[model samples]
Target: MKIGRNEKCWCNSGKKFKHCHYGRESEQAITKGELIGQSKNIRSRKCCYVPKALQHECDRRIVNAHTVSKSGSLIEIADSTNHVYGLKINLANIFKNKGKLVPEKIGVNQASTFKGFCSKHDKQLFSCIEDHPFNATEEQCLALMFRSVAKELYAKEGSLLSSEVIKSGDKGKQLADQLSIQKFAADNQLGIKAALRELSDFKDQLDGQLLGNFTNNLSHLIFESSRSMPVAVSSIVSPVSDFNGTIIQDLGDLNVVAEQIVFNSFSSDGKGYVVFSWLTKSAIILGFVNTLIAIDKAGIFGALIRLFFGLAENSFISPEWWDGLPDAQKKKIESLIMSGVNPFKFDPKGLLIDDGVNFSGWNIDNIRKINF
Candidate 1:
């Protein structure tokens, strides 16, 4: 006869099956047998995104929702408007090829959807939040997109690690890196949360403020983009030699490096922001005071980095901005790209700077900044 989890042990030990023989049997079944239990409590799987205020009365009909909409192709360009662009990237390849100078091949696009909200909330509340990429004109949209990608990536990475532990019963080097990435992703989530809180708390005071603007006026950059790229791009770093053949495993490293190059346009005293898309391996950095100095700091990698920036700038800003730059600055950037020295070996101290960006327009110069 089959024994229930709460039933007494078949060995007549007067203990619950889960506490005795069944426990050992279950362990053995998981380790030695091919079949594993797939059952889960439906109620336990209910969505967590529902606000507590509305959750109590709502009939939670939970569904797996895509953090980034999956409707469009991974990369697309419209003939009608050359300015609009859409893109997505494979996150798995980025992790698998961590220290490599270049990815062996692009990874298959991974799903960003997860069970997070009920059908009602998913459509009414969550949908609006996820729509930031399309609707937002300022940097807040990037922050929202980053948070969404980071949250989903963290969940997926953890699930993969758990599956590996069950299948191979080993925690290897990959696991260590995965764990580190997971932790940083979690921290990124926290940073996003703090940013949101700051925004919400000071919304009344900072109306009509631009926290930051798009890199190339590519307001339509994410119009048709897949949801998978933000996390993928955020996790990748160039100059493969920087981390001793390992991509950045810490969020702090990512923030510092990105600020040094991509966000160089933002003021040194102001907040820094970065949004990367997988489609073209392009990034948009915001809130920098001077764009030229930032490009200079990229050194030998300036060419590749500038290429992506050029793509973004071309898409958004008018050609006048490019033409407006001093010829001397243009030559300097071109020279750095030609030099071809590994950026890591150059001025390492130049890369280190502020750790986080303020997405909220609230001036907290007098207040202690919140750390992610």
Candidate 2:
């Protein structure tokens, strides 16, 4: 039987489900004792209590988003529109406690964000915040801020999004919501029509090329083909072995794919975001190379690094706001991509950034398989 993500792991490390005890469930949860000196906005109480051990199946537990501190405090996201919230965390604190963040690849799953994430000058949320309730962890603060700003942006349109719409339940879904497609381009300012064409074109092949023969004969491979480009555009899969919609296993790499997906989906103004992503990639590579050079650490990856940056500078990077990257970092990035070694096989050591994990072993893109 296939193992569900939420099921107890067969490895049995006394950790239940994923990394133990629905650990991933309440992503907003901070380690209990670690909250000792949290934020001044958070009050500590003698009544503080740790939760009891889990008894029932992890899936049976319900998530309570409105959790409060024993000191009678609740996290609040003041509606702020003038400011667009990016990752808001005290990185210095994290560096102090966790040591340096190990400088690695970082990518949000299905990592799409609004192309131009700026607020009207009058609506800036980045300004004015006396007391941050969360401490040390910028991610939590940033997430909270992103949600708050997003809500403010949505409110302007008079749309009342349900709380359920904000669940971190699926990164892909979250990325879709953030793009605000339906509203971002109600009249098509971001170019949604062209993006949808790819999907539509693929769908058309089934009807026009296959005729009715595909109605039952070839419906199964649609999702797989859409993501992986299929072995050949014309080939179809057996009906019994298809129809799964999951995509993207190596989330760090998703920084590219997700950005491409959303940028492609924009009805208008997308060219700007597309350009921005390439710039971002270029900047990362160049910056890394510069850091290495400063420390005299450049080794064999130099060529690959330069190639990655070069692609950003010379390749088809659409919009150019992202060109704001420093010149040195951009160069190294071009080198990485244009290097002789294949990116799929080079497997840069310690290549992680953010929570991205290695996907080198994935036989397919999503599910790990079994050879019985």
Candidate 3:
């Protein structure tokens, strides 16, 4: 199908084709500066919270709240300078690193932070886990997962809104190039839309629990480590397979809502913990969680490190710990982190499977569950 000369542009610029990409198709399209500026501007937009009711009590100014608390979690991994190496994967960094994901030193205050909450709401809603010690109680688990959900939703919304600017990359191309670019953009937008729907539903449930000081329709798995690993993370991932290489959900089918699980790692009160949280009805994720549980205690740390590197970019690592790793181990970890960023190197089935790496330096001392 061909767009008419006077029809709305395919790039969603809301301008007629003749006035937008008509004659300029043969010329260089949007510059890198414009694209970068527009993208940054889009992500910079802030909101109080997802629920409308809470907006009434929101502080006038939005703050960059840390998904992993600075005082409780990041401090455990920070070095003498109060800094950790966080995985930085953005347009600017990618270009600088030649399409590789590299770990860069980040101050504790800035690591794992997102502009998703107001000052008052950030402190008020997370007081249970932030102000108090982590005991894996219902409230603490709920708060941990809620913060991850909020940050993930904020990121997805930003990506969805960046479609127009992203599609403008096709401006300098021929008709064939334009069609190809627009088609890919269309498919990617569909996936993002589906994710937004699922995340919005989950966030609503969390809102109710946080507001009422109760938990319902939520399930979580807590893995306790008596020793703290020199790493901390907060992220939401939709795993397509379990550790045994069994398929869990077909992520290719955009019509079927993908199963998502919130995974966070942090250390508090002389112990490190890994927590998995999801809706009770998410049978797909429940099976995935069970697979995680079935892993022998000896291999749990390796499996988790793989998952964190393969699926999460919001993770941070201690500089001393990372620099101390052998060259082979560093390359292995870097490869896993790049799989999520570089599509050509991605292998979905290998994400959680045991590959005999046996990553060390952490142990699971106990396991606990709530309403699973």
Global lDDT of each model?
A: 0.32, 0.23, 0.84
Instruction: Give all TM-scores, in the order shown.
Output: 0.33, 0.16, 0.94
Query: Which numbered prediction scores highest in TM-score against the true structure?
Result: 3
Give one digit per residue, the lDDT tens place, for model 1 in 257-303: 22111111111112222232221212322222123223332231232
Which residue pairs overlap in candidate 1's backbone?
216-316, 216-317, 217-316, 265-288, 265-289, 266-287, 266-288, 266-289, 267-288, 267-289
What candidate 2 gets wrong by more than 4 Å, as runs, is 1-315, 339-345, 348-372
| Residue lDDT tens for model 3, 123-179 | 888889888989888878888988999998988998897876667788778888887
Using lDDT, rank the candidates from best to worst.
Answer: 3, 1, 2
The better-scoring model by lDDT among 1 and 2 is 1
Q: Residue-wise lDDT of candidate 2 within 54-77, one digit each (tens)? A: 112123222111111101111111
C-alpha lDDT (0 to 100) for residue 316 of candidate 1: 15
Could you tell me which 10 consecutive residues in candidate 1 have the lowest summed lDDT? 260-269
Pick the winner on TM-score between candidates 2 and 3: 3
User: When superposed on Cα atoms, how far off is each prediction in RMSD?
Assistant: 15.0, 26.2, 2.0
